[model samples]
Target: MVSLAAALASLAVGKASAEDWAGADAETGQIADIAGLVRLAARFPDSGSVALRLLNAQLAAGEMTAALQKIVVLYSRGYRLSAASEERLLDMADADQAAWLGSLFGRERQSIEASTVFATIPANALLVESLAQDPQSGALYATSVVSHDLFVSVGGGEWRALGLRDAAALTGIVRDPRNGMIWVSSGDPGLGSEPLPGFRGLIGYNPAKGAIVRRIAAPEGSNPSDLAIAPDGTLYVSDGLAGVIYRAAPGAESLEVAVPVGTFRSPQGLAVVRGGKRLYVCDYRYGLAWVDVPSGKVNRLSGPGLQYLDGIDGLWLHGDALIAVQNGNRPMRIVRLVLSSDGKSIESARVLEQANPAWTEPLGGTLVGDQLLYIGNGQWNRFGEGGAPDPDNPPGPTQIRALPLGK
Candidate 1:
């Protein structure tokens, strides 16, 4: 059996492919096929895709008992298997096993409460990935991933397109509190209406002037996906495609690599803590970790009783806890991770919202005083490759929700 420590150490090696099977274990000298899958499942416990692969592998190896055990594990995690897959499992199980497995269906659906729509963006905006709020005027700003535009709304009014439109696939929007300049990350994930030959970087817009004041180009071939502003006004950006973190000192013309490549696999959401001394980074595949801002040293955050932290898309620091938008999870939930006093581990995780009926896939959000205003329906599936609308999946107005976080 692979130990948890060993599995985490090899996390940076990346996720296993579905076709990966037939290998020898270098550590235990055992057949590594099933063991490798087991290690992946352990690392990504909340990933329904990984769990299904493990279950299929067990069944293929004629390990019926192991397959049944995997099913129980899936049930505990609230993973919903497809009807066809469930039928196959029942066909292969004994009467007693079938009876037990039948009761696990529909348990993954959770009730949604305490969340309401704050604003709605029209369908023409396409896929909006992130939002920001003007601290002074209470205006909301949203960035689009498909339409390649930035939009703004005031006083819960309709969203209006802003002037900036040169970037390809705008993402992650945040406002610098000191200057009130709204910053947004732009990248090309091959989801744009027009082909932007070579444009991927960060754009700083002066909300007052309605114009882009500063622009910083990301590294060549890097897709800058998210942004986080520290308490001191320093900007931190995550390159999701390149697995790198970039930092820019206030008013700096260029970006410096804070955490170099190979440290994370697909880093998404970023949150700063300890007065910007430590940055909590959420790696979509390997879960969450802390990066020392000055030295760039990384320490994975883990402890007993912590829920799986993988698949988090948006992370925000709320007092002593982190609110995460987990769009990649099976059911796609919002969770609050209360940090330990030392900020090294999670003491507990509370679900603020889950299985939200209004969400297609929750993306990025901003913390407003004691509440979180997030994009509820992302509408990513409505668009196909190269930013064409999928006829089968018609687009709908985007919904942003306001979830109150009391002190």
Candidate 2:
């Protein structure tokens, strides 16, 4: 994370625009401006440095509720506060707030209970984004953000690689139960750039034979973030940079917009209804969005009794509830959102896990029976100052854990 002073310096010199604050915050230094920084942090939840500065300002101002919220948000974003800073904040808090801060930021949750380590992805494929597993055989499939290979393991066995070297930054993967084939999405390395030559949108791999079956490319320059395969084999891809969801029917010539553009702000994970008639999308800027498949209409899910609902990266439909991996909020965690009768608004949210020691940067996952198998630590924060992977400081093995739902 960039220092607050340097981030403010960019704004002072006009080196960064209002649209590029996320990038500007990482460039360096420290400064003050509590209200403005807090508002900016709320707007761009992904900017860890902005949130950090807000925490500093809140501590100085003796704002208890606001400070706790920033602490939780920073913790959720995987940002650890400095010992001096934490002590200063604690000095200003009451006993109750102190205890809450200790529990919220401490590693005590690491001892609450341990989720089973389903598999350990190789160090070479350290940045795993999403997971998909076969129900019958319990074989797990994982995608890598830095490598073109897909990692697969069966029944807690050793992981094997399925090469898709032609693709870059593989984001999401899913299995078709009917054919037992795995479909994965890959596009440009990051959201800002164009796709390299010969990029594929959604590629199908025959796991049984360990060979590529087919490749479906999305519209030009589209960076597919996450995908959900319907019961009838229709594929839905969320373009994070474009803020549009594209749908492709089975054996279709190409991909097309399922919902109109501007329907979301950086839509990430997606979950499809069994009939392929509806979808639940995670909008990074906005909250959750419910998409009507047939009408191409989208509605944001919001009302009373719902808070900390934004910053969701992975979403899964589990019976009547929607399980979400919310990495973009104050306390990075997994939540079970109970939907209303109309399937539009959230009645309530139950946290499955939060402040777990294993969460370095949680992204996506797959469901295996009663368990939600997900990447516990994606290590997205390991990147260097230049916004590139630092080879000299490599991220170690990727950890996969199963959050049992007791279904």
Q: Give all TM-scores, in the order shown.
A: 0.86, 0.74
**lDDT comparing candidate 1 with the true structure:** 0.77
| lDDT (0 to 1) per candidate | 0.77, 0.71
User: Model 2, which residues run further than 4 Å from truth?
Assistant: 1-114, 191-198, 303-306, 384-392
Tens-digit per-residue lDDT, 1-407, candidate 2: 33333332333211111121121122222346786775665454444545666776777787777777656645543445666767877777788777766665465322223366767888877578899988888788888876666888888888888777587678888888889989888776462244454465888888778788878878887877698989999989888777778888998757888865645657788998877888888776555777777876666564232345567889999988889888876557787887777677667667788777766767789887677888888877766543356788778888888888753
Q: Please report the TM-score between candidate 2 and the true structure.
A: 0.74
Give the clashing residue pairs of candidate 2, or none. 4-30, 5-29, 5-30, 5-31, 6-28, 6-29, 72-330, 73-330, 76-332
Error of 1 at 119 (Å): 0.9
lDDT of 1 at 156: 79
